[model samples]
Target: MWADPNVRAVLVLLAFAAAYVLYALIWPFTHCGACGGGKRTAPQSQGRYWRKCGRCGGTGKKIRLLARMFGRNP
Candidate 1:
């Protein structure tokens, strides 16, 4: 299976995307809480401000893009 052209292409893409997200998540300056520069008075951003919440990790953005790409939601 690994020798297949399609399989190799997909594995390469998945590996690259995973590496990017891992780098983004591990970087110290990536989280908002570490930088400390945003106002958390808004209702939507209340719990997500400054990397306070574990769900969004201060970015206030969902990681649903990959889920959608794979035709699944959770």
Candidate 2:
């Protein structure tokens, strides 16, 4: 089975798909609570910039969207 090129390709594809699905399930995309998902306007203080998001720490990912849809916290 492993010797077949098609089988190998399919296995690899499946592996990748599974990994992506797992990752998405665990960490679905979410808007950052801080900065209001980057929509908040920053105040210029002597050319100073805004700090990192306090909720997602500037990662822009707060809670998982999937979890929120399911009424669960991620």
Candidate 3:
């Protein structure tokens, strides 16, 4: 049974599938900036969760934080 062509094909497909699964689990992010620069911006707070802001390139407005801390309107 192991020598059968169909079984070999199935095994090869399963091996590839397993490898892909492992790769995906280890690196879930597709556009992760782990490469050069690696300078990521702050995320915006949404109730409790903070999502990456596209407008500011993921960097939340720092000035806004300072203004709020100083009791000024942002």
User: How many clashes in each candidate?
Assistant: 2, 0, 1
What's the lDDT for residue 39 in model 2?
53
Off by over 4 Å in 2: 30-74
Cα lDDT, all candidates: 0.53, 0.68, 0.49
lDDT order of candidates, top first: 2, 1, 3
Q: Candidate 1 has which clashing residue pairs, if any?
A: 33-50, 51-58
Candidate 3: worst 10 consecutive residues by lDDT? 29-38
Model 3 TM: 0.42
Q: 20-74 in candidate 1: lDDT tens per residue?
A: 6665454423223433434344577655543344544545344344444554443
User: Which residue ranges in model 1 land beyond 4 Å of their true spot?
Assistant: 28-74
lDDT per residue for candidate 3 within 1-74, as digits (tens), equals 99899999999999997776666555433433332123343455333323454544444333333334445442
Report the Cα RMSD per candidate: 10.2, 6.2, 16.6
- Model 2, position 66, has a per-residue lDDT of 47
In candidate 2, position 65 carries an lDDT of 55
Name the top TM-score candidate: 2
Candidate 1 to native Cα RMSD, angstroms: 10.2
